[model samples]
Target: MKNEKCGGAATPRWFGYALQSLVYLAHHAENDVRCPSGEIATKVCTEATLMRRILARLARANIVEAREGRDGGYFLRKPPETITLAEVYRALEMTEPLCTGLMDTASDGMIGMEIKGAFSGIMKETEQLMMTLLEKRTVADLVKEVYEVKK
Candidate 1:
C-alpha cells in the first residue's frame, strides 16, 4: 500500500485580506498620512479587529507602520512600487500546503513512493508558478489596475 499526504487549498483568507489591504494602502501611500483604523476597516467592509490583526502582520513585515495616540493610525513603510505582492504573500503564508501524514505510513509500499513523488512535484511546481506571478506584480500595479477598472 502507498501512503501519501495532500496539501491544502490555493490561498488562505488572511492572504486575501493582506493583498486587499496592501492595494488599499498603496493607493494612498503617496499621501504619507495616516487614516483612522475604523475608516480603513469600513472601506474594506471588514471588522476592525480583523483589520488590526492584518495590519499588525504587515507592520511586522515592515510593509506598513502603525502609530499610537488619538491622531495615529497606519501608513505604508515604503513606496507602493517597491513592495511586491510576492513579499506580502510570503509574510502572511504561515502554513505548509501539504501535510506530513501522506508519507508517515509504517510500511513503505511501491505505490506510496510513486504517489508521494508525484504529489511533491506537483506541489513544488504550483508554488513556483504562484511565486513567479506574484513577484511580477507590485502594490502600485494593483492600485492602477483597480483605478482603470473603475473608469
Candidate 2:
C-alpha cells in the first residue's frame, strides 16, 4: 500500500530496516561502541518506535543484546559475519509464505480449490528457495555492499 521501496512482499519492510540497523551497529561495533535505538532509527530513517520493535525481535532471537540505564542500548550478540540473513528472517517469525494472500482470491469452486492447492505448493517451494539464498548472506556482507555502492 505504501510507496516505499521496502523490498516488497518477498521481504518484510522491517527486515530491511533491521538489516540496515544491524549494519550500522556492526560499523559502530568496530569502534567498541553500543548504538542507541534512536541513533539507529535516525540512520535508517524510520520511527524510533518501529526501530525498537525490530530490535526487540532481534534481541529475542539472540542476534543482538540490549542493556538498560544511561550507557545502555543495543549491540550485536555475535559478529556480523557469523549472523546469517536467514537467522534474521526467522527471528522476525514470518509464519506464512510470501505473497500467500494472492492465492486467497481463488474462486470457491473445484477449480479454485485446485488452483489454491497449486499455489500453496508453489509458495512453499518459493519460501524454501528464498531461505536457501538468505542463509548464504550475513549482516557483514550487506555492510560491505553498502560501502561498495557508496564508493
Candidate 3:
C-alpha cells in the first residue's frame, strides 16, 4: 500500500470551499440572486452535502446568508468586492500552511523550538501578505481574472 498522508496539517477543507464558493457567488452576483445548495455544489464540482456544510460555515461567518424553504438558498451577505480572502481564512480558522511536519524533539531539543519560531514568523508574514492581496482584490476581482484567463 502506498503511504499516502491524508488530512495532514493543511488548510482546513472549509477554507477552500468557502473561497471557491465566494468566487462563484461573486461571479454570479449580477445574475444569481440566490443560489441553492445543489446548484452551488454542481458549479463547484463538490458533493451537495459537502457544499452545504461549507455554506453553513460561511453563513456562520456572516460571509454568506442562508435561507430555508422554497426559493430558499444562499447569497453573499455583502458585496463580493468587499469580501477578502483573509476574512474567509479567519472565518475558517486556518493557521497552518498547506503542508507541515512534526518537529523531531528527540534528535534536536533547541532545533524544534527554532524551527517552530521560524515557521510562526513565516506564517504571520504569509498571512499578512495574503490579507493585503485579498483586501485589494475582491470576489469580483476573481471573476474578472477568471474571465480574462478563459479568454
Compare the candidates by TM-score and give the number of the best one. 2
Question: For candidate 3, lDDT tens digit of each residue in 16-135?
Answer: 666778878877667767889889877777677767766776788899998888878888999887777777767665545433343233236677666876766666677577778766
Candidate 3, which segments miss by more than 4 Å at Cα? 1-10, 95-114
Judge candidate 3 at residue 54 and give its lDDT: 68
Against the correct fold, how does model 1 do in TM-score? 0.74
The best candidate in terms of lDDT = 2
Q: Mind giving the per-residue lDDT tens digits that candidate 2 earns over 1-151? A: 2334322222367777888999999988888788889889888987777788889889999999999889888999999999999999888775455566757766577888779878878777888999999999999999899876898
Q: Distance from true position, residue 88, model 2, in Å?
A: 0.5
* Cα-based TM-score, every candidate: 0.74, 0.82, 0.71
Against the true structure, candidate 3 has what lDDT? 0.70
Report clash pairs, candidate 1.
Answer: 2-112, 4-102, 5-102, 7-97
The better-scoring model by TM-score among 1 and 2 is 2
lDDT of each: 0.72, 0.82, 0.70
